[model samples]
Target: MRVPLRDTVAVAAGVLAPFVAALALLPLRTSVTHTNLALLLVVVVVAVSALGNRLAGALAALSAAAWFDFFATAPYQSFHIQDRADVETAVLLLVVGLIVSQLAAYGRTMKRVAVADATHLERLHGTTRLARAGGSSADVVRRVRQELVEVLELRSCRFEYGTLIGRPPRLDPDGSVQVEGWVWDLERQGWPEGEIELRALVHGRYQGRFLMTPAPGSVPPPLEARLVAADLAAQAAAALDEDAVSAARRS
Candidate 1:
C-alpha cells in the first residue's frame, strides 16, 4: 500500500507530538506524576497504532516504550529492563501496536484502490460517449483527435492511411493539415532512433500515411490510444463501404 505524502506526514507528526508534549511536562514530575506520565505514553502508543499500519504502529509503540523507560521510569534515564513486568509491558505494547496498525493500513489501502477504480470507470464512460456520437469518418477522426489532445493533453496526433501498393503517401490530406496526419520529424521527438510511419486506411483501401513526432522525452502512447485508433479505423472502413455501395446502386 502506497501511503500518500500527506498521510505520511500526519502519521510522523502523530508519533512525535506526544513525545514532545511529554518532555514539556517533565518539570512537574514526582513519583505519582511519573506513573501518570507513563500511562500517557501508553495512550500515545494506542493512538499511533490506531492511525498507522502494522510497521508504523509497531515502531511508534517501540518508540513510546523506549521514551517512557528512558524519561519517566525510575533510576532516571537508562534502557535497562530491570523488572520482568516491564518486559511484559513492552511486549504487550508492541503486540497491540502491530495489530492496530495492520487493520488501519488495510482499510486505507482498500479505500485508495476503490477511488482509483472509480476514476478509471468514469474515464471509460466518457470514451464510450465519444465513440457513440454519430458522425462522418473524417468528422469522427477529428473528434477523436480533439478529445485525445484535450483530455490526454497530447502534443499532436495524426491519422495515416495504409497503402495497397508499394509505398504509402507521406503527407496529410489536403484541407485537414492541422487536424489530420502529416509528415513529422521522428528525430526531433527522440523516438526509438528509427524512422516510423503512420498510414490511414478506409474499407481496405489506402488513404494516406501520417508521420507523428511526439514531444521530446514524452511518454510513449498508451495501449488505450492504440485500441481507440483501431476502433476508429474499423468504423471508418464500414462507413466508406456503405458509401461505395450507395454510389454503385445510384449508378
Candidate 2:
C-alpha cells in the first residue's frame, strides 16, 4: 500500500528539524553555553515527538547530541568533548528526550478511541451493504472473517457461529462474562486459534467468536483490541442476521 503523504512529511520534519536548528544556532557559540545548548535539543526532541512517533524523537535526540558534541562543547569542531560535565549534559539530552517522547506517545493514545470508532464505522457500513446483497449465513460469516483479517492485518482470523470452525465452545470468560459485558480475554492469546481472541455478540447476545493471530510481535492494547474484535464480530452477526431473514423470506 502507498504510504500517506502527511506521514511522510511529518517524519521528514521530525528527522531534519534538529540538524537544522543546530546549524541555525551555530553562530551563537559565544553566547550559549554547551549545557544551555543541549537544552535546546531537548525542545527539538519534544517537537519531533509531538509531530511524529517516539522513533522520530529518538532520531532527533541522537542528531542533537552529535551536534552538541561536535560544535557546542569545548574542544569544539571535533567529535570529542573534554569536560566531564559536558559529556553528562549530552547524555542527559538523549535520556530526557527519550523519556519525554514516551510520555508524548502515551498521550497520543488518547486518540485511539476516535481512531477505533472511525475504523469500525467504516467496516460496519461496508458489511451492512454486503448483507443487503444476500448470502448464506456461512457465506456471510466467511466474508466477515476475511474482512477482519484484511482490515486488522491479523495473521489469521476464524469465526464460528454455533458450528465447528475449530474446537468446541471455548468462551475464555465469554463476551458477556465481564462486569459490563463486552468481549474480553485475559490470556492475551487470541481465542480460537490466534494469539488474540474474543467472543462475538449480536445485540449483547453471544453469537460466535473470532480467533485472530495478532501481527507477529504486535498486539493492540487489550481494551482497544477487544473493542475492535467486538466491532468485527458485530458486523459478522449482522450479516448472519440478514442472511437468515432473507432465507426465511424465500422459504
Candidate 3:
C-alpha cells in the first residue's frame, strides 16, 4: 500500500525522537543501568503511540530497543550486548511497548466508533420525528430533504416519489450500498452528471428515490452508512407515502 507523506513523517519522528534522546543521555550511561534506559524508552514508546498510529509506535519501540542495546548495554556504543540480563531487558522493552501500542490504537478505534454510532442514532431519531410531523405534502418533502442533506452531510440532496431518474443507480438493483464514479464540474466543485440514489421500498412497493450529490471525498464509512441509509430509507418511504395520500385527498 502507498503510505501518505504525513504518516511516513510521523513514523520517522517516532523513531528519531527516542533515538536522539538516547544519544543525548549517553553521558549518564555509567550511572543508569541498561534496565533503567529500557524503562525510559518504554515512556517514549507510549508517547509515540499517542501521537501516531500503532505501526509507528512499533517502529519507535524497536528503534528505542536497538538504540538502547548500542548505547547503553555492556558492549557500549555497539549493537553487541554481552550481558544476558541486558538482553532480557531489551526483549521486555520491545514486547511491552508493542502491547502498549496495540492498546492505544484500540482505544482510538473505540472512541471513533462511539462517536459515529452516536451521530447515526441522532440522525435516525430526528428523521423519524420529521417524517411523522403533520403538514402539507410539499412542506413534508422539503423538511425531509433538508434532513437528508444534514444527516448525510452532503452538498445537496433531493427526494421524489416514483422511479429513480436519468440513469441507472450506482449500485446493482439488489444492492443497497453505493460509492462510485463521478466526473466533477469546476464551477460547482461537484459531479455535474453523476448522482447516487437510495430507494425506499415499503411492503414491496418502491416509494421513491433519495438523489444526492456528495461533497468531494465526503463518503461515509461503507458499512455504517449503508445500514443507516437502509433505515433512513424506511422513514423516507413512510413520509413520501403519506405525502402522496395527502396530495390525492386534496385534489
When sorted by lDDT, best at the front, the candidate numbers are: 3, 2, 1
Off by over 4 Å in 3: 1-12, 133-156, 160-162, 166-194, 215-222, 249-251
The lDDT, on a scale of 0 to 1, for candidate 2 is 0.66
Q: Please report, as a residue range, the 10-residue window in candidate 1 with the lowest summed lDDT.
A: 171-180
181-200, model 3: which lDDT tens digit per residue?
Answer: 44323223322345667677
- Models 1 onward score TM values of 0.47, 0.53, 0.74
- Checking candidate 3 for backbone clashes, the offending pairs are none
TM-score-wise, the better of 1 and 2 is: 2
How many steric overlaps are in each model, in order?
Answer: 8, 5, 0
Selected candidate, larger TM-score, 2 vs 3: 3
Reference-based lDDT, each prediction: 0.52, 0.66, 0.71
Query: How well is each residue in 1-251 modelled by candidate 2, as lDDT tens digits?
Result: 23446567757766788878888778887798877788887888787877777667667778778887877887887889888998998889878878887787667656765786687677767666766676556766777777767665667877645743544323333222232234434345333333444566676566667766656544333444445546667777766666556789999
Candidate closest to the true structure, highest TM-score = 3
Report model 1's TM-score to 2 decimal places: 0.47
